[model samples]
Target: MGALEPNAALERLYRETGWTMRQLAQEINRVGTERGTPLKYQQPSVTQWLNGQLPKESARPVILEAFARRLLRPITHSEAGFPAPRRGSTPQPPTLDGLVDLGRQDMDPSRRGVLGVGLFSVALTIPGWPDAVGRMDAMRTDPKRRVGQAEIQSVKDMTDRLSDLDDDFGGRYARPMAAAFLVNTVAPYLKATASSETRKSMISAASLLCYLTGWMAVDEGAHGRAQEYYVKSLELAGASGDRMTYCHVLRGMSVQAANLGHGAPAVRLANAAAEASPDSGARMRAFMAGQQAHAYALAGEKTNALNSLREAERAVNQAESQGRRFGGFSSATLAYATAEVRHALGDPKGSVESLHDHFRLRDSTDRQRSKLIFSSLLAERQLQIGHLEAACTTWNTILDEYPAIHSGRIDGQVRRIPSLLSPYRSNPLARQIYERSRELSAK
Candidate 1:
């Protein structure tokens, strides 16, 4: 091949970012690691790319993502001077069609291995409200079928049942059922003709169900799959003019990012959710502020995190005084958020205190799965503070409940029990807990 010309397009974008070559390389490596594939690119590799040497196809996405995150906008392959993706310029399928396809693949056992490979991307392009609102393509209508309130209510009721099952049993047992329902039942309802009012309501209901499915996917440790479902939920929510669901889904995505320790993306997503929130009631404010506080804490904005926490506290108080509850956010939720903020801000003792408050204030509305996860967190934090006996007691509580929940997240916590106790094995209680954990994990 002839000697290649420099990639001036990429060089221009690089200049726009104000990132040194090494900084750019470091950013790419960070994104690669976030995508579950670590890289060790140095200035030399970035120099090659700027000099017109092509990066491997896998690395191209990481490079573009680094630029996108730096520029706070979407960066296309062509814009980054990379070859167009395989699908080239073809538009994505319409919302309903895409949802059906995604759900079908999720529910299919043979196709699940492929789905599992999708990595959570920190640079994933989040659709802004204006961009997503009413952006759905005209769906094909089945003239023979027209949905009414009955159909909408049926969908809502089914979502509630599925959610309850997820809270009680675990997403591992509930997600497949949800995916199958989405493909077989909800997909058909989306295509059915209906009055404009009924159509919008049906779509809104579908959006909630989609969001719940994504939440379950998160619980099952399917982060990439969860992100896809969340995007679809946002599209549906916006199409139906349901700002509430849209904001809720965005907040859920933020929580996922924060849990995964992607602080910047978590802050961005949480702020977007709070910004897009509709007419904020006290409870709504608390819901948004609580997540914002956690995200800000994770991003290391100490002042912002504390301010957000204070705001959430005031909102929760206001909501309680008014005997009003919206968005299922309560004092208990705020306490949990406080625990997260404390933990992120490097106060494990304070975090433990807040966790205790959380459980004390928790009502029946809290999911059993959350109880287990937070209990595990409490134990880990207890261990961190040199309270080995207290930590062992907490672990015993978790073990008592662990057998009933089949969550990938909870299972991960259980797997950590032995290692967490290994240093304290000389203590009888710690040794006993460690042995118990080994036996339970073996099953």
Candidate 2:
């Protein structure tokens, strides 16, 4: 059969009823389950419907039932623009046009609930379209400009707040907040008429915002977008002559690479960070070294990992000797980075030690959240080394604090706990921890 015509009847019903793709899918799934004809539909399937694709024989009845529920009016197969059932056909992936159509229908200003649902549903599945890297490279070749003290201070304040938000709530909320700041605060200043000095500072600030946005994208599993943002940020940092910001961006790139199993590239990026900021304060040196150690560990270079870890320790010590007045790094941040390296190197005891140090230095507001993450990490490491009871105990602690911490990072850590405890799933303690985590997530 030729491609089915756009289903104007279904489209009008969906629009008049103010139904989101997700809500429609959920209602379909619910009805199917109740009638003993269970159906499985992912977000992508809803996307297909919104695109006007005729549902296959198997999906048609359920879609009709779902729209009936949504519109509170009976819908028949003929009314939904379907012919008699025919079986056996391959399914196509949802298209961007389909998603956009659904978004337009659900984003109507007159429907409050539908609008909220549409925004979240669409945001969750938004594709990361890559930008041309050559543009950034061209900008980098442009003449460098000087930046002023006033703009520098403003950038500093914004960066500090962004960092605090990341640490507090992880990357979920941080991404949108950073994006707003970039569009509203940094981007305007970068394009504004200013002296050479002000322009340079504005560029520096904009580059940092780009880096932050990229880091947030990585956290949300949008690696392609993250890479694009990182490249752009690196180009901007080069033009601004901000070696410190360059180091931060490189460090971020290393983390992304390591997470994606590109260990060698991660190690190279970490080394570049250290080399670019050799004269930076002790804390900065330690942070770079800590990243290097983690990268080496991921690359299976045990000796290099150990050496880098020791170097990081030394850098932290030197930073402490500088009267605890390091400009960029704090004791707590250094300790957290050190703990991550130790955890990567299979040193559970050392990881816990460093984590304890981090706790001691962390501000009161961060204690509950950081502790939840550190505890989860500790539990995973324990399970790796066959410390079942210890792992269970740590996991229990994480579960207890999880309700108060809504960080995406912490949620990831929690999700990993079940697999780590798979061997002990039959054990009462392990099952208890797992059940509690499930319950917390349900809430």
TM-score per model over all chains: 0.78, 0.62
Could you tell me the TM-score of candidate 2? 0.62
Give lDDT tens digits, candidate 2, residues 1-443.
77756767677766776767777777878866765668877667766665677666666656765675565444444455555443222111111112112223322324423322311111112111122111222211111223357766887788878777766666555666676566445543453456665666777777787787677656555565566567667766765666677778878888777766677878878887777774666677778877888899888888998788788778878878867865445677767777776767667778777877876887655545556767777677677767788888878877776766546567778777666666677999988887777677666
Per-model C-alpha RMSD: 14.8, 15.6
Candidate 2 lDDT for residue 433: 81
Between which residue pairs do clashes occur in model 1?
none
CA lDDT of each candidate? Answer: 0.86, 0.63
TM-score of 1: 0.78
Using lDDT, give the best candidate's number. Answer: 1
Off by over 4 Å in 1: 1-93, 109-114
